[model samples]
Target chain A: MTEHPGRITREDVAHVARLARLRLTDDELDLYTGQLGVILDHAADVASLDLDGVAPTAHAMAVTNVLRSDTPRPGLDRDEVLAAAPEVEQHRFRVPRILGEAP
Target chain B: MDRYQGGGVVTEGWELVIGLEVHCELRTETKLFCGCRNLFGDEPNSNVCPVCLGLPGSLPVLNQRAVELAMAIGTALHCDIRPSTFHRKNYFYPDQAKDYQISQYDEPINVDGWLDLPDGFRVRVERAHLEEDTGKTTHAGASGRIHGADYSLVDYNRSGVPLVEIVSAPDMRTAVQARAYATELRAILIASGASDGKMEEGSMRVDANVSVRRSTDATFGTRCEIKNLNSVRSLGRAIDYEAQRQVALLESGGVVEQQTRHWDEGTGRTETLRSKEEAYDYRYFREPDLVPVVPDAEWKAAVADTLGLMPAQRRARLVELLSGGNGAGGNDGDGDGDGELRVDQIATVVDLGLDDLVVGAVAAGVPATLALARTANEAATDAEAARRLDGSSYVALLTLEASGSLSATQAKVVLGDLLLAGGGDPAMLAKEKGFEAMSADSLVETVGQAVAAEPDAWARYCDGEDKLAQVFVGKVMKATRGQANGKAVVAELQRLRG
Candidate 1:
């Protein structure tokens, strides 16, 4: 996810920061632009290598259909799970008023 | 399935184009990634496990039953099964157990299929992807909207439940076509045994992408995604309102903006919920915990075997039976000779899954048309009892009617009694109801008296005013206390006119 599509620009970093809800100073934005740019360049160098006959890999281990049979079992206690939340109301987790806006 | 050229749900010069995304929950014993019970109406937060709660140190394990159900749904939709990978859809919501929901992104499980409506309109299905459900949140405020809600209560009982999101291409050209597509899709999901397809309980939900364009224009207009359609009726109404809204905007020289709209059932309008920009940016990335799922040939075959006859096929089977062709060709379905054989009635009978009763009766020498009418009208009224009603009893009742032993009025009453009391001899029920066939001489006298009572109408009938048959038949029926056969009365009237 840290890898860029091509080259990472400062504006791209700012947009990513906005989506991540990170309030970064201008200096930090500039710093991450350089940092992510190098990572993208390394990724590009690896991508530029010629290995035409090799199949693409999505995972390192290269396995498929790792599954488990469906069966019901006990879960965490309700009170215990609700206690872990920041707020609880009426036997449920309670959260502050949130806007309809999205990331 | 009536094909819309233009101006079906839009203006005369406009045409509607709609694509639907249907999200249906998978019927499974456990959560998609955990063993916690996937049961609804349970104690709140009782189903929460480490994996579902997104707690650290817990990795997800795909449920085999869930994958099987997804494949079954895909096969029922006639989609090509393929390997799929899960990705994290990043978003922020209080009810989301995970800030990034596990969903299939670019690679989905099913693709490149089409659903045939009973009317034979083929709607191409783009893809059906596997995803997990979110928790339920109820806002506590006057408007019950998140904008002004004081707080929200979250129920994790539904979190991590498996779901299949079936997306359709923009092929529908009217509100009715969109509705037919949704209804057919629901039937397919239920027939595949993948989901219950209950919209009231939120097992199945639909989001419509609707736009209208000039009939002469090749380019599509800006579309809005209408969300929160809980039922099929709401789906049609919302699409109709949204299409009109867009058409109005264009006519007024107001450019339509791309946005997600909310359907307010109470207000009967669609309003902007949020900009499309905020909704589409789901920074998706591959889930490292889960591997890709690829169904082999044998597994795909097994999934395909689970699909039974869907609604469309069932409807065609009934049509074939009605037309006296053993699944050969379509029927006139004009509903003229024997029964009110309208298309919608057939659909209703099939929807209730009662076509078997009609089929059995037809096989037993009862007229198919009469059997269909009784099945669609009387039996459908008490569907549960009718499903349990014996085929022999049904055939006996219809046989009595078809053989002219019992008048249509008496037959209807007998059928109602059979349905209410579970089962009985139809002939005996009619006799108990004092239904005795009027003698031919009495019917002739009754028709003569009826003609004398309305001489002017009789003269007009003799002059070929064909609508007066019901007037004389009514009189004869009343005089004989609904015991006289209508056809006999009509025959007597025709004799007197000649």
Candidate 2:
């Protein structure tokens, strides 16, 4: 959908903000669009590299299979965890009328 | 909807294309990233940690057993193992504490596999990727459904539980094929120890992507995803209903919209849950917390070794055993003591993990038909205990029934006791239940009375109406209090006729 690489349009900023549930003013949108544009442009500069042998990376660390055994350990107490929630009912965290899957 | 065809047939010339996404929970002791117990029906919110709750400063660590189970599942379906990474499927929902589900996108661990149904149909598996499950949310207030629910309570006990969502290519054509694919995949999941495969318990779930086209050669039409199909029966019913709905929409000169719909099992129809127009753009990005999962060759082989005989292999083994190691494999059987085991009987036995009992009983000189029948019918009634039913106990019950020492009904009663007790001496249970075999003379007297009372039927039986023999046997069984052996009754009836 990007016609120019790393070019963040105001519409793109607005769309992404809506997806992230961020209510942004027009001035803020213009500001973030420029900020995000510069950030993406800096990152997209990697595309200029000509060497093709580099493997894609998910993390900065070179670790693989950072696994733990399937063992059970006691976690946070239910009372303690529920105490931090905004609402509680019948031993569960109650939220206001949140419907089914995200649309 | 008024013109909907019966049995989910879209029109006479239309073709049904279906793809299934099955989410199965891995049978591990802890959550996918944390050490909290991965259990079902525990106290609400009991299993919670900083990592699973998406608290800041907490890092995620992969669970070794989850990866192994996923690999075993992929191997069972003939998948290619590869290095994979996780991404965040960003969305907002009460079920997920993170507000964004960590899932595998673009790259997954297992790919390009195929699952073969017992009837020789193969559904290509596109990918099987690991992810974390979400919390349980129960809607509050009127209707209990989301339509009018005032609030919803969330339990994070299920949060971060390990799940592998298997996406299949849209290869299925008929509703029957979709059901069969689910069934066969469930069996494989259980056999490979990847999951418990209990759909009713939510260990395994299915969502069908159904579309209708004019013909098999035509391009696929827009599909509406049907969600929350909990059982194989409901999976078939939902697919049929969704197909009919799409076809009806198209025939009425209306366009089918690509959307997600919930299959209401109560209403027996698929209702729109959400449409694709407002679909969330799940901002997928790599998780910098956990590193890549690159399964080495040795570890992959070790996982493969744990995958024992799948359902198809077990069914074939039982079929070969029932044929005394010589009969060809086919389902062409009547199952009336003709020394041939029906294909469906073998499938049921194997599916319930009762093939070992059948194999054991048949090896003890019990006729294959008798062993297969009892195991497939009576033992199948209590599959949980039947799986643990000892070989000797099953053989003992079958021997008594086959040798005319106990009637079929007596064997059934004693077998029920054996199953309930988990294991017991069959003869002792029979004696304790006072199920004594009748004397031949007593049996003759009983058969004589049954024949005399059913003279009209007996007349036809004598004139070679073989089907009437079952009528007299039923009558004799009732008179003798179910202690009359069917074979002996038949022999005595023949003698009286001569």
Candidate 3:
């Protein structure tokens, strides 16, 4: 299979926008796609700069076990918790129809 | 969807492959990268700043405390403390003010770790990484149900909250084990002082990935992920439901699709949220605004110091401390019958946030059993002690019982009074309120009065009618507000009647 060009196109950007749930305008999508390509390309450059034996870094801080004593605390009352939700009923948050119809 | 007829339909055996991604909100006074408060509920948008809101030209400053907490959790989980990196997970959901979430991706802080289960079983932990929380969204006017009427409200109080997401390997085979694993994991987190494990308040959220395969199959089946499961019970139930759904589909000669699903805890089912996507979906890359986080050795040591006693070690210590004559302390030789507090009982006390109080009261000279009772009595009898007599007051009550100043039953009575009235001393209040036991002279006088007043009853007792013994016993006890010892009262009354 022929590898696609290194540059990320508008189509690639549109596909991502759809997945991420962003309703960007065509021009904005175009702009971000190019910008994202450049950013990824720069990251690719960093990925290339390697000392053969260098270790991969995940966390910047060298920290160890941080913990709390195992103790149960009084939780927020149901009403107090429910009061914060914009839509709530019977002590739970309510939302809208999230599922699309199945084929 | 194919409907299976009948309420209790029996199905063939299918093994479930369950994995959990637990996202716990880290306990910190401020946001992960900003000074804004990390509180859950405040006035909407009140805790926002240019830094958290991702305004132009505002650089992200990593919180030292957040990193320490992350590493603390990593160590507690037995994860390899590998060098890690943070990347911007690009996504645009309504809750996030910043389109991209600053999170650890390919290079996670913690590598492979294992959590021990009750029966020597283990849950494999894949990675534990740090990330900033997104703002909250509330659908207004609507039932908050996805399918309904009206607009939604947004709250940013939870935004920028420091969080660590622990992803586990699909090693769990049963829902019960999954629940236990989550509970144990939460217990460890709480013990480490990392998080409160308040699932209901959204501090601890779980996403379960579940699939079903033939019991003997070595290869895995397609999996469906259920998100936003807040409670342990819900996590187990959702996993079971999702796994069963997949099994049913496979049994019906259908395929199990890989998708993101939402759990409807109300109906006890899962629904598809999104389909699987390739790498280009997220388009993750290095965060330009923030520099690499290189936690030095000293910082790692400081973080290690932050870790408290882990749950397993704490449990063993508690068991040893409560164990009698086992060289673990406590006066087990007294034969007072309380050798060590049961694990369940200790767990209960911990649940009530009364661990310190129990220990304090015990140290202050209360017997184990009497502490609760004494606290009750002290609370009922003394106002000041009553104010202090919560679940922990039992410790002091135990002391009183151990000292022989109060009986177990009396301690309970005092505890009840204190729990309700909020102030009173067991001894002084009992005396002032005439709750004290009647003196011998007073009991004798009342018995004599009863004999004189009731000639028939007295004659029956004089005739040695055995039943009259009960009558005399009742009369004396009535005179003493039920505090008189029944046996003593019967004898005194019998002599007076004769």
Candidate 4:
């Protein structure tokens, strides 16, 4: 994982924001680009470490296989779960027209 | 020079390269990360919880059974089970309330496996990774499609359900081969007891990547992914239609664009849904909530021990049984060379999941051919009942048929009754149904009376009009109210004629 300085461009930020459905303004994109640059710089610094034998860590700790039994427990009431949504219809969470097909 | 005929044209000088991605819902009792019931067709939103709903301050805990099932699936597919981690696939969709999905990235639990189809073509499995399912979205309005819908309703009951996405290498050369791979994979999934492999209920979903290439070329063409294929038939049809569409496009001086297409079952064509440039970049990153999955050797062995006979192995066993041989000594090296009837009988037995019943009958000394026919024909009619049937009772009925104590028709009728009514004494049931076998002495007496009465028909039978034996059998059946065995009557008539 080599460092590529100045790669977090404003255009990249804008494209990612758009994909995330975030309507970011020009100022916001520029601000995020610089912020993202700092984060990438930190990642680059970590990548430049000379620890060849160090294994990549997906989690902060060495914990693995933490799981619960598959037995079912009571879930929230239908009305209670629907109460948190903006709108409810036919015991379901209703939203505006979906713009695109499902992935 | 192998060509396929579809869309009113011979697709000559071209080959289809297809790969399939199948998502199967694990049969866990609860959701993947929450204690909510992982049931289908429940009341909408009833199975949701704060964890699955992605409420603030709620964290997800992996289900132990889900992991074991995943391991079982990996073992069944001959994949290497390794420590795997989950990542967040970032996307914006109404169905995913969390605005992202927790899925495995880079390192999955299973990798580098291959599935050998019944026809003996091996499809390399790239990976089978674990993930969570999204909610259901129902589009309202006239078209009932997302393009022109008033609004969509989301049900979170299915959200956060455990799913394993099995990805295959682009090794299939024909739509038929693709279908065979899916079918065999589904059987493996079922055999592993990890998933129910129900495609119609959305438990199993298949997506295909299809591309066409010149027969002499080695490089692959631009592939288009077909989505929302619900059935194996639809999968095969969509691949064929899409492959032919690409060939026709290239032949007519046009280039096939790499895109995602929707299989329209009504129109029987693949319609463009989205193109490659517009495809969503998932922006995957490691999930900060859950930990990695590392199954130790002991646990892996325990899961491996649960593996049962897969469909292919079961099919081979049934074929051996049908050829009148035991498991060890069955050296019919050419079971595949047998005629199509034997092939179909073996398939019917295995596909119906009744191989164990037939095996049990054979173990009980019943003839293999009779057991295969009974299981495939009579028991297969009601699979649910047949599954619960007592194997010994089935063996007893077949034994009666084999020992000449009951006619074939009487045995079949008895078997059907036993299947519907659950376990009971087969002989007692036969007696209750008035199917008592006719005595040998009485059969001779009846044949004598029939010969004295029907001289003409008897003389015709003696003169080698073998068809006239039916007349005497019919008379015996009429006198005995269908209790006398027709075959016994025919035998007795032959004895008298001699």
Model 3 lDDT per residue over B431-481, tens place: 454544344445567777767777897787788787877776677667666
Worst 10 residues of 1 chain B by lDDT: B326-335
Which candidate number has the best TM-score? 2
B1-498, model 1: which lDDT tens digit per residue?
222323365788998899999999999999999999998798789888998888889999999999999999888888999988999998888767678799999899999999998788999999999999998898888978867889898988898999999999999888888888888888788667788777878999999998889999999988899988987888888988898899999999998898889899999899888887744577899999999999999999987887788888888888887678432221212245433345766787776667888888778766677777778777888776886787777778776666455767777888899998888877678878888644444566778898899888888899999889999989878887787778767766776777
In order of DockQ, best first, we have: 4, 2, 1, 3
lDDT of model 1, residue B185: 87
Say which candidate scores most in lDDT.
Answer: 2
Please report, in order, the local distance difference test score of every candidate based on alpha carbons: 0.82, 0.84, 0.66, 0.82
lDDT of candidate 2 at residue B328, scale 0 to 100: 33
Residue range A1-103, candidate 2, lDDT tens digits: 2234348788988998998989999989878887888778778798887759987777898888999999998899888898999999999999999655643
TM-score of chain B as predicted in candidate 1: 0.73
The alpha-carbon RMSD over the true interface for every model, in angstroms, is 1.9, 1.5, 9.9, 1.1
Candidate 3 ranges beyond 4 A from true positions:
A1-103, B1-13, B277-280, B325-341, B347-365, B369-394, B401-498
Please report, as a residue range, the 10-residue window in candidate 3 chain B with the lowest summed lDDT.
Answer: B1-10
Question: Which clashing pairs does model 4 show?
Answer: none
CAPRI-style grade of the A/B interface in model 1: medium
Query: Which residue ranges in model 2 land beyond 4 Å of their true spot?
Result: A1-6, A100-103, B1-8, B325-335, B338-341, B388-396, B399-406, B424-498
Better of 3 and 4 by TM-score: 4
Interface DockQ of each model: 0.52, 0.63, 0.10, 0.73
- Tell me what TM-score chain B of candidate 3 gets against the true chain B: 0.73
Off by over 4 Å in 4: A1-7, B1-10, B325-338, B381-385, B388-498
Best by DockQ: 4
